[model samples]
Target: MVNIRRIGLVATLCASVLSLPAYAQQYRFNYSKLYTQMKNNLEEGHPDVKVAFFFQEHKTSRLCKIDKAWMEKDKHYEEFVIPPSQELIVPLDDNLRQVGPLVYVNAEQGKTCDFSMVVMTKQPLSGEVSYQDIEQLLPQMSKMLDDLGGMFSSWFAPKVIGLTFEFDGVKQSAIQTSKGNTFSIDNGKAKVNLADLSKNESLLLPQTTFRVLPLLEK
Candidate 1:
């Protein structure tokens, strides 16, 4: 006779193990790989390869204040106060200016809040960037963006907010998100369909501008 209790336990264990990958996928944005890729592009003289780091701070957090007690001992605490919408330009060739992980505190709750950095790069990136490039990076990038959002908001998910590629001086930007996997573009008077380009290359063009934003749903 089949042991019903043992079978149930086995099924439970299998479900738990199967869910591990989905959980990891939910929180695995890799900043190190991103930094390396940016550095490489800069070294190869990819034209106008600019990197931007975005940070978010809560309005009432003590860390947001210039004279917070924690700031006395922390040297890099000031960087956290930069406005979320503002961009911190990172010099890809300069190690000192490269992006790194950062930590912050919420004084009211006496709890430490962590932030995952978001990066934006603009340049001529046709062959350099693509859906495949993003697909590979999305797992990590989504986790990072969601981490940042978690610092202040109770609701957050992974999303790509903006992506634009300039081809022959005609700027094409992603205008809409379809099923959270595909994006439509604003071709901007260009004869060629930007969507077709994305489909063909499975990559984002180099010298492209893109923003990884938080999604409301996974």
Candidate 2:
């Protein structure tokens, strides 16, 4: 009799679980489409750009040469590389963040090399992000961007031009851009003409999460 009652309870719980709304499930970020767009843009814009890969130690800004031994040991963890360019895309996690694919620009005689740093959350984010989560991720993304900037050689003259955030909601009017700044969101993507956020670290609420692709120029 007890076994029969327990089985009935389990079935009831299973039915309730299945009836939950779709939003309750994990939200998916379309990384592939964005990656394809990034590659295409790089190819069209940076026809002369050169790219190389280097292994960077954890928590260190200096990038080391990739040796054959490291390859054999599978120590070379590649996050993402935009072809024909040495730009990197970082998976931004509050707990487990991996930074890599450090940009190595070999500019031609009189030209300059430019690229962007992409910071994205590792896991699928909810439709709504709490204030606390945004607060926490703000510092993490800022530091990661600064850390990447530090890896650049002084001669490159790295400058932050602008940044874009790709997510599933619009927070345009709610967000206050600086003077002469306008926020635009079309099909779940928004852009900010701001940079070096490490300097200011101002908060943009309700973005939930982002793949922070910042255009760096010479």
Candidate 3:
């Protein structure tokens, strides 16, 4: 079952650039504050769960829809054909910045929440493994998942509030979970549906600018 959750809209329409200069630059958004918030939420809700990330599909224009679906759903779960980017199960800490795709896991309101979303160009991906430790086959795991973009959110019978992520002192995203999945986000849009969006993650309406700053020197 594809469990979906809703958290309203966390990302607003900020300034958008028509196109990048010939020398495409990688922009970074300082998310130390947000990461700290996520860590706290993970503790209260996710416990020992590992949060991660994955890139969007290429040319089909599905990212905006995925992002939008992610905002409204409880579990924020969905499965799709992988484009070219990879998925990374990030380690818990306060020193990590944006990578390929970013995801998180937690137990909110007695439900399991999983979110896999990112804003990177579509590219081939590698390496992905089940959260369970396969000590016997440690050498047979890949760090990326190819051809499938899956975000699964499952809630249990016990009623509870899911983990949430706040930014700039605002509750941008929260996981209001039910027995199953409830909300979704794709194609970079937050309030639309899968059917209403394109199958690819290519630029559609416009690019959502996330100004990322490198704090390594700081």
Displacement of residue 198 (Cα, Å) in model 1 is 9.7
Q: For model 3, what is the error of residue 143's alpha carbon versus the real structure, in angstroms, after optimal superposition?
A: 27
lDDT, candidate 2, equals 0.31
Highest lDDT, which number? 2
State how far residue 73 of model 1 sits from its true place (Å): 15
Return whichever of 1 and 2 wins on lDDT.
2
Residue 8 shift from truth in candidate 3, angstroms: 11
Comparing 2 and 3 on TM-score, the stronger one? 2
Query: How would you order the candidates by lDDT, starting with the best?
Result: 2, 1, 3
- Per-residue CA lDDT of model 3 for 1-218, tens digit only, reads 21222321112111112223442222122234235323532332222222234322233322211211111124433333332222322334553433222332221122112223322212211132111211111111111111011222112211112211112222133211222223232322223222222233221112222211100100
lDDT of each: 0.30, 0.31, 0.23
> Candidate 1 residues 97-197, lDDT tens each?
34443222222132222122333234223444444544444343333333333344224332432233323333455423222333433433111223334
Which tens-of-lDDT digit does each residue in 101-172 have in candidate 2?
221222222221121123333343435333343444444433433333344423443443444455544634
Any idea what lDDT model 3 has?
Answer: 0.23
Regions of model 1 farther than 4 Å from truth: 1-87, 90-118, 121-124, 128-131, 151-155, 158-169, 172-201, 204-218
What does candidate 1 score on TM? 0.28
